[model samples]
Target: MRDFSQDIDWLSINTATIRKQHGQEVALNTLLDQCASAGIRAVSPWRDQVAAVGLNSIAAQIRAHGMALSGYCRGGFFPAADAAGLRAALDDNRRAIDEAKILDAPCLVMVVGALPGALDGQAHYHDIARARQEVLDGLAASLEYAREVGMPLAIEPLHPMQAADRACINTLEHALDMCDALDPDATGALGVALDVYHVWWDPKLQQQIVRAGAKRLLAYHVCDWLTPTRDLLLDRGMMGDGVVELKKIRQWVEAAGFRGYSEVEIFSERNWWQCSGEQTLQVCKQRHQTVV
Candidate 1:
């Protein structure tokens, strides 16, 4: 119920939203500078971008510019074809957790992988339930390290359509179930990253948000879903341009005590990505104010 119309003080940009501006990869440093200049306070940088720019250097830049991270993107993809692969993933996730702590991110978002190799049009395993189990096991291992390091893990439930490839955890309820199962004590080390683009269509959304409350809601992501969609992966809509009930969901979230950044996390390859980063950001601000 807070007013975003006056200023985008609560707005944060997920760097991937503008990773490719006008068909070119936007440098993380340049993007950080742009967000700061645009009065955007926080960001959530992907690991690849951070790795490309050197973790220490990016951490220094973030500190120098006084920027905040809404969350780290990301540290999950637990499913694998073999035990060695699983061990490697666990090792990589531990490193990711260390990196997240180094950058002082509030939480590291988890995009729990499904079906092993389905992302590349070939699946190593077709068992969705098994994938979910792997994610839970991986999270349990990661959580132990996270508690020691004082970092939080956020499980972001991808949309149902992406269940086969991106994430098997595709509902707020499902994500919350994992949190409850793992961190039953309501520990702050584990929670869910609620993205409207993914769970906006779920009938149980409001109830789940209330169930999540403040402690289990680690991050809030926003991006409208385009109707008559083009690419399933891309073609995300700007906040006001699509059918997503942005304000209604935010109210549920805020009422549940989640007073955090409404991070814009669109993956628009056809529309926004084809436009200048400046224009895309300007629209993000306007939409954040008027619609979100």
Candidate 2:
């Protein structure tokens, strides 16, 4: 594994990690400036955040800062209630691919949706198998466009807890299965974005990481899983603050030939979000060096 102790050359901050400061949304431009000031060479900003600030302007700012994107925030959520909804999802993803290309991101991370309207407290369908199938079809369609545009798609498998509303693909194995079915050649066009917060508890994590190898492992996200958790979606712990075996997993990832940024992607609603962006970023840097 590469040593992060000396410098943060390989560290990338996902904007969501510090998107909120003192429980308020910080502008993407301000966040970019803060990242550059902190000597963070890269970031992964969400589509909505980028859209809120305007795409071309943000691209210019990123260039001025000389920053790189580890991956794009997302381009999935393919499952929907109807045919038109599915098509809209595909259209949205195509736009996301274009945005990712504009930002020069390495890959567009995917959080494939599940159970349609489940997130809104009323599921349109309860058939998970149907959702998984829709995800596969949607991904296959999206992959065609991604290939045409020369942008890689990294499917981020949410933890199983998120399967009902966020992502139907809940395991690294399942993500890779889709990759194999779609890309088949490990061509780097289709892959997986492995997030420690989501996959740390899996018993087959190391084995699956090995199975993913380097080609399929397009991006890696780091954050701890809080014990006695409060919110499933927002209560992610900072590195070393929880029980994830950070180094060991990195070792496995590196051994399998993944040499990418260790992107810090925390969604701490009550803790880190309550702090200033500067403090949250400083802690991210420190924890990344010492523990991660």
Candidate 3:
């Protein structure tokens, strides 16, 4: 494995990690500048954040800083209430792909959606199998466009806890299955974004990483999973603060030929978000070197 202890050249902030500073939402431009000042080389910003700051402007700013994107924030929410909704989701994903291209992102991270209205606490249906099928179908359509645009799509399998709402593809194996089914040739255009916070508990994680190899392992996200958890969605720990074995996982990933950024993606509303962005980023850089 590469020695991250030497420098943060391999470190990339997901932007969401420091989106909120001291309880206030910081602008994407401000966050970008801060990241540049911190000597961070890369970032992965969300579509909504890019939209707020304007696509052209953000693209220009990234170039000015000589920065690169580890991956794009998102472009998957395929499950919907009806045909019209599914079509709308596809349209949105296409636009996201274009935006990701504009930003020169390495890949567009996908958090394939589950029961249409589940995130809002009112699921449209209780059938999970149907949702998975929708996700498969949605990915097929999106991949067609992604290939045409020469942009890769990285499907991020959320933890099972998020299967009901955030993503139905809850395991790395399942994500790779979808990749194989869609891109049978193991083309670089379709792959998985492995996040430690989501897959650390899986018994077959190492085996699956070998299965994914280099071509299918498109992106990697890191964040410790906290114990005595407060909010399942918002509570996330920094590296070394939780039970995850960060170094071991990275070893497996590197063995699979994944040479990419260790993007920090934390959604800590009550902890890190309450601190200044500077403090949170400093901690992220420090912990990444020592523990991650």
Lowest lDDT sum, 10 consecutive residues, model 1, at 225-234
Worst lDDT 10-window in candidate 3:
224-233
Q: Which pairs of residues have clashing backbones in candidate 1? A: none
Model 1: residue 169 alpha-carbon error in angstroms: 0.5
Best by lDDT: 3
* Candidate 1 runs further than 4 Å off: none
**RMSD for each model, in Å, please?**
0.8, 0.6, 0.5
261 Cα displacement, candidate 3 (Å): 0.4
Per residue, candidate 1 scores C-alpha lDDT tens digits across 64-139 of 9899999999999999999998999899999999999999999999998888989999999898889999999999
Give the distance in Å from residue 255's predicted Cα in candidate 2 to where it truly belongs: 0.4
lDDT score of residue 64 within candidate 1: 93
TM-score of every candidate relative to the true structure: 0.99, 0.99, 0.99
**lDDT of the candidates, in the order given:** 0.93, 0.95, 0.96
lDDT of 3 by residue, 233-253 (tens): 899999889999999999999
- lDDT-superior candidate, 1 or 2: 2
| lDDT of candidate model 2 versus the reference | 0.95
- Residue 73's lDDT within candidate 3 is 87
